[model samples]
Target chain A: MKFEIIDYKDTRSGFGEGLLELGAENPKVVALIADLTGSLKMDAFAKKYPDRFFQVGIAEANMMGMAAGLTIGGYIPFTGTFANFSTARVYDQIRQSIAYSRKNVKICASHAGITLGEDGATHQTLEDIGLMKLLPRMTVINPCDFNQTKQATKAIAKHKGPVYLRFGRPKVPNFCPPDCEFTIGKAIQMTEGKDVTIFATGHLVYPALEAARILEKEGIQAEVINIHTIKPLDADAVINSVKKTSCVVTAEEHSIYGGLGDSIAQLLSRELPTPIEYIAVNDVFGQSGKPDKLMKHYGLDAPHIAEAAKKAIQRKA
Target chain B: MPEISELQAIASQVRRDIIRMVHGAQSGHPGGSLGCADLMTALYFEIMDHDAKTFDPDAINRDLFILSNGHISPALYSSLARNEYFPVSELATFRKIHSRLQGHPATKEKLPGIRIATGSLGQGLSVSIGIAQAKKLNKDEKIVFCLMGDGELEEGQVWEAAMYAGANNVDNLVALVDYNKKQIDGSIDDVLPLGDLRKKFEAFGWSVTEMNGNDMHEVVSHLKQVKSQTHKGQAQIILMHTEMGMGVDFMMGTHHWHGVPPNDEQAEAALAQLEETLGDY
Candidate 1:
């Protein structure tokens, strides 16, 4: 199936829209922001539901704990902040108060990966997915576009437990269907092929579809699948796809160590061993640059994914 | 409400449980557990309005307590079991493998009373503030209480939560500090002085009060006064001054018994000092 771009939008706007919808639908839904309401596009939710919204004012740790506390009274709290502060900054707070205690919190993080641009390495978070996925009860999700992020945001409210919903800063192509069903831990196959499978997540998913197009020109029919959920990964989808394709290329806007690539590698090594090449940041910190430049610099664009797919296909015996 | 004498008897028995639970486990914090025994007993037996039988995590319309300094799980577990949240027999399983009584208070094992996991300090105040806000949102006029150690104030997150609660007027929270003046390494002043706790909490916009945590009557009355003061514009905090180990003479006056379990002889001596009022769980 061919995927088309619907528009261009920042994924955080999708989260804000979804949160506003949740405020209308579920009275139990509350939002907490650590002083990044504008950046996270949470202004609408904050403005609409003043009573339910809490402006935590640059205290990420307090925001996480408060989110957990809100859950005890049957309130579903959605905390907003940069991906870095959301994960690494208040890791212990999330670990003890949320994940270990099994609090139903939606940790909605914006400005993920080097795509955060201009703000440099400190604001950018390339390790959030790894940090959150390591926690016992955390459900990690990196949605591809605006629509998918909005859908994922609404979906996780119904999901009981801690969730890390990661989204990007730049105005990437909003290609995901607005009405498409977004089941957590379910993979969406964008295209079909028999030679190799290109698995991607977050901002890199659109590039994976582009990579499939690039590979198709070279007589390489690449199957592109969007693995939105990192933890509790869609193993059945992954196994079934690799069984047909035999070779795999995993792509993400994160470090190759603990991101989607590592998750896929662990799964394949245990269940179905296959030749795989990773298209991700190679264990290095990001720098200040444009989102497109960073994607190309870190070798995370379509051409790089296509090249990785070729390498994986060649390795298949 | 239980009489002040009855509360004192329960406190004495709770002290015994803290001592014996630590001795039975051979590994638990005894000093703080012993130090906060009266306050825990007073809250469970006389101060808070809670049901011991049906444990609900939401705790809607009921007073909730969070043990922030979770190292004193023995004290919390004993208070909980003695209050009939669980069978008093489970007190013996403190910190044992496959036991609901974890080394720190946790909701993981489905323990009846615990609503959250708290071992790492300075996080509980923020959690309590959150729950307090939730109660306000639900229009459930219940109060939320959080207990923290004096040394736990050193964590930056505590001050952060303090600032939020004070600024937001989370009026339904009563945070109690077990100001025993001792920690693992040494006295709180020697380790990391919490410099004028009342002034600091006041600066963060809290209404500060002080009480003798080891005095059962004082604990009961002071907590009752604090509860009455809730929803009157500011979050409440009680700087409860307590001895490191109140009943056990050898354990008192030092930080040595902060986390050390007593030997058989020491346990016998400690148990002999307090009468077994609640039948020695």
Candidate 2:
């Protein structure tokens, strides 16, 4: 299958655009931010619907608690903040008030993982997916690009229970189809090949796609699947793709311990027990640098994914 | 308002329920539950404009109350059941499996009057402020009330919510601190002194009021006056002075009864002091 690159856009902008559209479409939607509207690209939503927006200042825990309460009055509240502040600073608040009670809240987290850049390890969150995954009823989504992120932002608003929507900071290739139907917990198969199953999420999917193209030049047929939603994983897709390939490679821009790779590993270990490889950050916090440089330094680029796919295929014997 | 005798009778019954429920369960917080018995009786019976018959999750045009410091579930469960949110006989099932009354107040079991869960400390004020904002947005004239413990003020998020409510002019909220001065370990003064909560909340932009929470007459009058003081450009906080355990003579002075259940003899002795006005479940 041939692929073309679309224009580059940040996934957070997709979330912002989705929020703006939600403001016009659903009057019950309300937004609360932790004093970082500009950073999260929420200026448009705040301006267009001033009455629905709440500037919650620097208190992320309070924002989460307030979001839970807003559900009592039949409002679907969307809370905005950095991923670190969104998850790490407020895990207990989210666990009790939102997840345990099953409140209709959308926790939109921008600047996830090492891609947050320049701001370094403190602002960058590598364990958010794992933290949210521990909650029983939380629906976790780490959409690949701008279009998918926007679709996910709108999708979670319609979902009744609590959600943790994760997106990135850097502008990546926005190649997802426009007007695509985004069903939560379903995987999007981008390319179909049989050599090694390549599963990716968030910022790493673009590089995984690019890696598939590079592998095809060398007669290696690598199938690439985008597992956007991490919690209610598409286990069937992972198992089916691995059934054909006999080996797998999982890629993510987060800590390999509890992120997408761990979920895929758990799925394969019990169901298929295939020899798998991973392309993710290895046991270290991120540092101040450009996002591209950080990706290359952290071994999360296309070449690294292509290498991992080859390693997993070689172990197939 | 209900007559003083009527309200006092309700409080006595709630106290009876608290001691009996805790004694029956063999494990519960009877001290704080008994401490806030009169407040719960007056608020649900005579003060707030809420309906016990037709239940609604939105709670539009109705007063909303949140138990922020939820360890005192016995008090809230007794009040909710006695006020007809559910069958009063269900109060006998406190802390048992499959019962709506949890060890901490929870909304997951579909308890009629509960809107949010609050087992962990210091989350209720933030949630109440959010509900107040919604009421203002929905053009509802009702007020939001939150009951917290003086020990819960040690949590930083309580102050965070306090600041947000004051700075944003969330004047439709009424927060009450159960100043029982006792925590699980020891006295709050020895554990971590709050250092003048009235002045502190006032500095955070609340219209502060102090009340004797155990006094039936004072509890009714203070809450009635404060309901009118809300929605006037300042939030309200009632620094209610209450004992850790108020009604029973043996449990009134110390924090030992904060979570200890009465054995058979202790139960009989404690039950002898408080008169039962309403029949036990």
Every candidate's DockQ is 0.92, 0.83
Best prediction by DockQ: 1
Clashing pairs in 2: none
Q: Ten residues in a row with the worst lDDT in model 1 chain B?
A: B215-224
lDDT of 1 by residue, B96-207 (tens): 8989999998885689999999999999999999999999999999899999999999999999999999998899999999999888999888988888888988999999
- lDDT by residue (B1-281, candidate 2, tens digit) is 67988999988889989999999899999999999999999899998899989878889999989999999999998898888999999888888889888889888568998888997999999999889988988999998989999999999999999999989889889999999899999999899999988889999988899999999889998998999888799988999999988889999889999999999999898888888887888
Tens digits of lDDT, candidate 2, A217-238: 9999999999999989999999
Query: Which of the CAPRI classes, incorrect, acceptable, medium or high, describes model 1?
Result: high
Task: Provide the lDDT at A90 for model 2.
Answer: 99
For candidate 2, the clash count comes to 0
Q: Which lDDT tens digits does candidate 1 get at residues A2-96? A: 67998999999999999999999999999999999999999998889999999999899999999999999999999999999999999999999
Error in Å for residue B100 of model 1 = 0.6
